[model samples]
Each structure stands twice: as structure tokens, then as C-alpha cells.
Target: MIDTVALPRPYQNYVYAYPHKTAYRPLTPRPAIADLWSGESTSTLSLYLHIPFCEVRCGFCNLFTRVGAPDGLTGRYLDALTRQAEAVRAALGDTEPVRFANAAFGGGTPTFLEAGELTRLCDIAEHVMGADLRAVPLSVEASPSTATADRLGVLAERGTTRLSLGVQSFIDEEARAAVRPQRRADVEAALGRIRDTDIPVLNIDLIYGIDGQTAASWRLSLDAALAWRPEEIYLYPLYVRPLTGLGRNVDPVAAEHDWDEQRLRRYEEGRDHLLAEGYTQVSMRMFRRLDAPPQGPDDYACQTDGMIGLGCGARSYTSGVHYSFDYAVAPREVRAIIDTYTATTDFTRAAYGRVIDGDEAERRYLLQSLLQADGFSVAEYRGLFGRDPRDGFSTELGSLAERGWLDDAGSDRLRLSPRGLAYSDAMGPEFFSPAVRAAMAAYEHR
Candidate 1:
């Protein structure tokens, strides 16, 4: 049996995207975006437009977004987005039909822009990029404070199927502790506004591991969210990192064991509660109501399809390359990057990113699939690479199996045991390539 004692903390890292942007560096003699997409299948691409403006920066946020925009900054940013979209659309070429399978507007807070600006943003996706917003499943992220009637109306009119609201805590005191300025009354009103619109799926984002958050208090937030009957609920474990508001005073190393234990307990409790309430677990952080109408096409797989990300804060992915502009967390640096992006007239080439080799591709496929609650098909892996995961990942699979993390039911598929799902954070990092790990490590977090 594998000895669990020597393993690191369970919440080591959250692997939302493989070979994270930190591993990306400047690509010398930058490759033209056209050349990168040339010969690649353009059908069923996912589109993402990023809005980097937020009303308030959450204490725990490390996202690449500025707190507020200057008078004309939002306009200038939109102009830049329009120019970039034109360049990308042209690059996609005319030989084959380019179609979007799914679309999303994310940020800091996408709804941070005014109503008319939101309309323009959607126009860029539809008019410039050729995505049929009305046909595809469109998801947008917003904060309770910014989920206004005007913004919700624009999103609904644009065929936004999902609206993800960031409500860290519904309790007034907890919200204050998390440095997210809002009241339960205001959040409820915002939820009401969202429901008044035609947007079908409402996702409430809640966080655990806040100071003074107990099982009872956590239930308060959960019950409040459930009362709204949101289609989706995302429970995120609070992570304090450098340059964030909460990181300023708290020592990340302090109370290590106790904090991990508390977070794990909360996670398990939340998971069980949601499961009992008929919410299906999509991932460690995501739970979807069983009756919630499904959005997006079943055939659009994130692992294989190309993703076109518009804006300074977003990243574009092709088969071989994942590229984006400079990334930063500090407000000043973020502003500088955004300014630089808006100033540039040339949006033709990839300025910075990392190349995905054959080995890294396999790792990405396995890691992204295995971390999900549904697990992955070994047959699919064999079909893709001509070899099964058991051959490529013998050591890692052995360790997980011995530790009782792997559910070795049948050879047709590979799945995580209940205990394995709980340790997804640790398991994900275990699959990172040494080169990618070194690149991420050497990246100086600003």
C-alpha cells in the first residue's frame, strides 16, 4: 500500500487548466495567429471574451482584473477587442466553415461594463467573430453588485444561457470578512433581477475556509443559495496568495494542518449536502441541479477543440499552442498590460505562450478527464495515443491504487474512488511535466 503520510497537503493547487499560463513565456519571432490556426479544424471552436473591470476586488481574488476602469478605459478596451476580433476572424480563413460550439463572457466581472457596452461586447462576438450567440450556449460571469437589471436585460437579449454570480457568502458578516462588500438583502435583490430575465441557468458561487465560518454558518450560506434554486452551485475553497488583499496580513504557512483539516471537512460536508439535495457533482468545485436544463452541445469537448479568447486577460488555445498577452495579478501591472494591449495595432501574432508536445498533450487529456467526477475512458485514451493510460502512467496509477484513490473496477475505464475525488488537487499536480513545473516555479508572481 502507498504510504499517505509522505504526501503533501490535499489542497495543494487547483488545476483548472492544464499547463497553466504561468508556464507561458514570450515566444521569440512570434508566430502569426493565422499560421497557428492554418490546417487546423476550425469547426466547433469555443469563444471567450474577457472583461477585466470589477467594482471591488475580493480579498481572496488573484484574477487578472483591475478594480475599476478610468473614464474612457472601458471604451478603449472594447475598441481593442473589436480590432483583435477582426484579426482573428481573418486569420481563421475562408476555406472551411468556422463555427462556434459554445461561447462565454468572463472576467473580473463581465457585467461590470454598462448596458450599452455589454451590447457592444456581444456584437463583437456575433458580428465580428461569426458566432451565433442565439444558437450556442453562452455563459457570463457577474458579481451580485453588478448584476443589475440593465446588464441582465442585455445578456438575456443576447441569448446568454448561463449567468454565474459571485456571492462569496450570503451572510453580511462573512461577506465583510471575505472583503466582498455586499449585503444579503442586495444579493437577494440581484438574484431576483437575474430570475426576471430569460437566462436559464443561474450559478451561485460560494466559498468555504473563510475565518469564523462554521458548519452551521456554512449551511446558512448553502440554504440561502438553495432558496433561489440556482441551476448550478460552485463551492470554492478559499486560497490566499501573494498580492491579494487577504494575503497582506495573513501568513499562508500558519496553522497549516488545522486549516487543511477544516477545509476538507467543509468540502465533504458541502458535497454530501448537495448530493442529498439531488445536485449532481460535476467536479470538486461544481455541483449541478439534476433537473437543470443542460446547456452546450454534447459533442463539444474542451480537451480537443480550439478556443479563441479575446481580450488581454484571456488565453487562446490551438492544438499545439496556448497563447495570450502578459499576465499579472497586481493592479498596477494589470493596468499596464491592458494599456499596452490597447495601444498595439498589430494583433496578428502570438506574443507569449507555451507549446504543447505529444507527451504534454496526453498528460493534459488524462489530467483534465481524470479529475472530473465522471472519470475517463481508457479505451478513448488508447484510441488517441495507441496506448492505454495504464502503460503511460503506471507509477502514478500504482500509487493512487495502493492509496485507495483509484477505483479499478474494469479495464474499460479509469475512475477515482470517493477518497480519490477528495484529493484531486494533489493528484492533478502529480501529472505536471517537470519542464512545465520548473517554468511555473520560475515565474515571478507580480
Candidate 2:
């Protein structure tokens, strides 16, 4: 019941010609076992359930989804999510009774579900995945106007603890022009209601540089957002992507409007404002409570080892391979994921593509593992892969130490220094493939 097909050598050669390494990811020399899911289970696991339905699709949004006309709606889809969880369970072998807290319902808008459907999906996640998701953090995305008291209650009762509300901008005009729905009063009430339930954290997402926004107005929204005192705040700058309405309106100089000094100034001023508010920098775009660890990639990677992404336009990362599928997928890529993971249940690194020689594997392990704030741990690395990262990566760390990008405090811990944190976004992709490394490095040099 599995497709054992493989890409011909010619296609693999064609793929390698371009710099899209992920395209040819399952290359030989990855892991040696048939099961890429081998080794000790990680401390956490995350599931990104994409709900591709939205009441209104904003002009700037590029996520895979449909709006309003609601033709393909059904409860069967929710059932499918649970079923996929089972298929994953079967594939993962003895899933090490892992303790997982984080599962995010993301999308064009996850709150697109009507009350009954929303609660049902939560129930499905609990029934299938919660068998192992004991005493852990569980969260979901909320749209201000749609997430009413009743809806919040259902999510809270059904194990949803954290709520990341899409409060893009507080200005009514900008909110309307961006086609995002928000009401200062409504959002305040909703936050108050959700807080009453005593959920551990509330993350408010803020965006800047919409078509109608000026630097002053953007600053106003930032200050208004800070008034709520959220446990977390995420700032997203508007970027023009291919094929969207905003993309169509791109200015050669400014991807959004004019891409001028004003836009860059807004980013710099906003960055300064957040730091002044006592928000320690995490990733380039995220800031969080000083007491809480910076979130995103670092906190994220710790919990996410092998993700099982379901629904449209989701990406899954495992030991040596990253599998992605949309509502539609490139035929070759889909076939490869199915064939590589399903066919070779006990499959190892070689089947993935390149042979992950010990040195290469150690190098990669360090890059992927050290991506977050907690940094790389020598003991955990040895426990999982049977060797120390110190043995393979100390040379690179020692060299990087002089640049003030890394620190090995008392715990044999490695972390990005303050200066290193500032340029991390620019520095991150260098750890990937050769072409990406060149591109990122060139970006920095420019």
C-alpha cells in the first residue's frame, strides 16, 4: 500500500543544478536507518492545523485558503485531521510517550470555523493526539471579532491555553483598508474575557507598513497595543510576495508602497520603541516578556522535531528531510515524500539523499540545534546521536566566539550575543545549503 517510486537520476541532476536544495533533500547520505524518525523522542511535538477558510481574505495575505463563498465546507475534514494523526502515530513507531504542549491552529484564519465545528476540531485533536499531550501547553489563533465569550469558553474547556489574536492595527481606517477586522473595544473585551479563564499566555500580533500607514500612525498602534500588557507581542513588517494584490502594487524601490527611507525609518523607530518598553529582543521580528525566554525559532525548535503538518499549504520537518504540501503540490515532491517516508519505514540517512557522513551530520546537527536561545547542549546531543556536538562543532564555535555572536556560559551553553541577535535574521540562512549560504552572505555584504 505504498508508492516505492523514485526520481530518475536525470531529474535529480536537474534539481541539483539550481540552488533549491530542499527540492533534492531526500538525497542519499542523510541517516543510515530506514526510519528517519529513529532516536530518542524529543521533549515536545507541534501540530500546525491549517484552517484554510476565511470570512474575508485580506489584500496582503498569501496563505493557502478560500474566503466567504464557502463551497468545500464539511465536518469530514475535521475527521480527516484526527485520522491523519493516527496515520502519523502508526508511522512514528513507539512514539516515546513524549510530553507535548504546543499545537497551533493557524491559517487564513483558524477562527473561521463556526462554534460547533471549532469545538469539534478541538475534540478531535484531544482524542487523537492528547493521549500523549499531557500537562502541556496548548494554544490556538483567535480573530478578535469572531472569538466571542462562548467560543473562547469552548476552546478553553477543550485544552486551549494560549490565544494569539490577530490584532494587526488599532487604527480603524488602516484596519479597514487592510481588510483586517478589529474593534478596540471588542479586542479589549475579548482579551479581558480570555484572561478571566486564566490561560497562561496571550500573544498579540501587530503589523506595520500597510498602504495607509505612516510612521507616526504606526507608532500610535504600537503604543496602543502595549497598553494591553500582553504576555507576548509579535511585530510583522509588510512584505510583498508574488501573485498577491500587494505584489501587483509593488514599487521597484519599496516592495509595499515606495520602499523608501520612510519605510526603513518605521522599522528602526519601531525596533527602538519595543526595546524601550522592556521587551528583550528574541528573533529579529519578535519580542517577549523579559522574564520569559524569547519565543519563535528557539522556543519553537525545542518542541518541534518531526512535525506532521495537515491541511493546505503546510510544511513538515523531520530528522533529515522537510516535507511540504499545499492544497496542491508538485507531483514529484509529493511522490518523493510518500515514497521516502512510507516505503522505507526503517529507512536511514542514505535513502534521504547524501550520506550524512559523521562529520557532516555533526555539523548539521549543530546548525539546526543551536538555532534557538537555549543554544546547543553537549549532553543532549550525545544522548540523541551518541556523540558530543563539542567534538564536531567546537572549532566553528571557537572561531565564532571572537565575533561576539556566541557565548558558552557555565552550562556549556551556546547562545547568540546581543550583537549576534540583531543580525540573526540576516545570518540564519548561511547555515543552510551552499547556494543559500552565498545568497545570504551576499545580502549581508550588500
Candidate 3:
């Protein structure tokens, strides 16, 4: 039940609910390694290892990764990462017999590494971290040019269940417009290779709102992606941010309104098309085939479980704190951070992060859960904190209810209507604590 007349327009901001890393500051005399992870549940943990090297830097890209590493830089980085992993393992030291339920390798492009290097990367995850790659669900991201036979072979041999490829657009002109260079033939070849490997699930990423993209062109891309019968498809709205190649060339104020409307129209079109094609909308961005196997741990919830992130770009999450190495978008800053990461041998304690108080945690819980189509369970929230969400976020909930965002059929659980989901970008930031907002505002984004 949505009030179409009162629907809010999309506010292009951070798509994810959590605070951006720019707000993170270095901790002086960092806390003890053991003390930071003490008494946390290890039964179902998520492991993330970052590979910050990519073959090319796309125009719209702003992740904490850099372009191709020099000849010897990759080796040095792997050596440092292995050392850091060993240290992290030693720090955990028989801590309730740690078990990893899900793991992922994310980066500028994990497949950017050579086949031998890919094997070594898997070894680091399995041997150094003590997570059995074969026993758990593993996911890896790849680009069209790097998804070669040898690389896919290594991934398949190492028990990678999901292979996510960034196929932003099938049209060469549109790809170039987005600063992603790839031919349609290259993308098709990569898709064939991925299917040949029998990787179980293939996720294709597509971006809407690119410059010059139209409804017809968008449908063409969708049809091309659907032909692959991918297990999952992610439709992203292009955002031009400071420091990105696209950000520099465009005038934000001049194009904001038009771009916002275009994105909304395209998002709705894509969502409806996918739903008609037997795909379920998991979130605004994620659409999964009905037949695809479950991807993550069923019993593990990110709000409660601890996550261990290794390498320069990875961010580790504990019960009360989330930390990572320095975050940057500018090429010079990113290179410097990567260089420092490769030179370091210590990886025991957090270097930069923020402390999450009870209020922050509650806000995170609500934002993360409500952004999804399934919403959240009121009873579960009460069990976790001994209070209902309505008790603490009554104002926010009431506002959403007044606008007909809440589902009318359910009283035990709270969920967003289709229109509310479309306005998630605006709603998520509204729940941010004043302190976090101030901290994020104070940090200079490169």
C-alpha cells in the first residue's frame, strides 16, 4: 500500500546504509589485538580478503583499489598479505575453534592476477586463515578481460561457488561512456568460460543512468544479460562522485534532477522486467533467479557475527567497532596506502575505525534490515536489545507509516513498500547519528 501522490524522489547519495570509510580516523596506540576480538562468536563468520589491483581504472570507479601493479609489486603484496594473515591467525589462537561459514575475494578485479598468483591467493585464504575453501561458500569478482580459462580453472578447483562479473554494458559505446573498456565479444567469451567451469552461480552486474542511456538501450542490455541465464543480476544507478573520472567531467548541479528521474524510471522498468522473468527482487539492487541456490550462511547474521577482513581495502567488523586500513579514492592516495600495506608485517590490531555505541548499533540494525524487501522481525529485534524498534525509532517509523511505506498485512514484522524501497537513499541517511554525520562531514574525501 503506497501513497503514489506522496512518494519521495530519489536522493542520490551513499547506496549502502553503513557509514563511509572517509569518516574513519587513525587510532593512536591502537588497542590490543587480542582484546579487540575477545569473546566474539566464531561459529559462523565471514572472511574477506582484498586484492586492490585492477587491469585498468574505470572512469566512474572510486573503490579503494588501484590500477595494475608493477611487475614485482604483486609478489611483494602477496608476501605481505601472507605474513599479515599468519599474524592474524596467531592472534585468534584457539578462540572457540573459529569456523568460517562464508568467504569472498573482492577487489578492483581479483582475476587481474595471473593464474599462479590466483592459486597463491586461494592458498592464503585456506592455509593462512584456516578457512577451508572447499567447505564453505566462496565468491570472487572478475572483469571480462581477466576471466580467462586458467584463472577460472583455478577458481573452480578451489571451490568458488559464485563468480560475479562486472558487465556494466553490452554496448561498446555505453561501456566507453562509463569508462569501462570492453567489447561485447569479450563479455560473451567470458560468460561462456564461466559457464564451462560449472561455477554453480553466475552474477552479472549492470549499471543504469549512464550518460546517453535510454529505455531501449537499457532493455537491450537487460535482454543480453538474461540470455546468459545468470543466477543473480545487480542493477546499479551510476553516481558521479568527487575524484572519479566521470565526476571531474560532469556538472552535478546542472544534471542532478534529470539524472535522478532517469534513474528512477530505469530502476522501475528493470525491476518489473526481472520480476516478469521469474526473478525475485532481493533488494533494490539485487535480483536473483528463483532457482539459484542460497548464497550465504542461513544462521549467521552480519549484525551479530564478527567478520575478518584482510589486506589494504578490506574492512573488519566486530561487535562494537568496525576498522580498516586507510581509505582513498584519489590515485596517488590509493597507491600510497597500497604501498604501505605491502611494506607492513604487522596486522594484529585495527589501525583506523569508529566505536559503535548502543544507539549507533540500533540504527545500523534498522537501516540494514529495512533497506531489504523482507524487512525485519520485531520479535528478533526485541530479543537482541530487550526493546522493540518502535520504542526507540518511533518517530522514524511513524513517519514512514504515515506515508504508507510500511506493509499493511504484517504487524509482527516491519517492511518497506515498493515506493519506500525506491527512496532508500534518502531514508537511510536520515537515521544517521549526529556524531557520525559530523565525523563524516569533517573528513576530506579525496
Task: Please name the candidate that would achieve the greatest TM-score relative to the true structure.
Answer: 1
lDDT of each: 0.91, 0.57, 0.86
The positional error of residue 250 in candidate 3, measured at the CA in angstroms, is 1.5
- lDDT string, candidate 3, 111-131, tens digits: 988999999999999988988
Residue lDDT tens for model 2, 325-345: 322222333334333333232
* RMSD list, candidates in order: 1.2, 10.4, 1.7
Q: For candidate 1, write residues 30-121 as lDDT tens digits.
A: 99999999998888899999999999999999999998998799999999999999999999999999999999999989999999999999
Of models 2 and 3, which has the larger TM-score? 3
Instruction: Supply the TM-score for candidate 1.
Output: 0.98
**What stretches of model 3 exceed 4 Å from their correct place?**
1-9, 15-17, 295-298
State in Å the error of residue 307, model 3.
Answer: 0.4
Best-to-worst TM-score order: 1, 3, 2
Off by over 4 Å in 1: 1-6, 296-298
Q: Which structure among the candidates has the greatest lDDT?
A: 1
lDDT-wise, the better of 2 and 3 is 3
Overall local distance difference test of candidate 2? 0.57
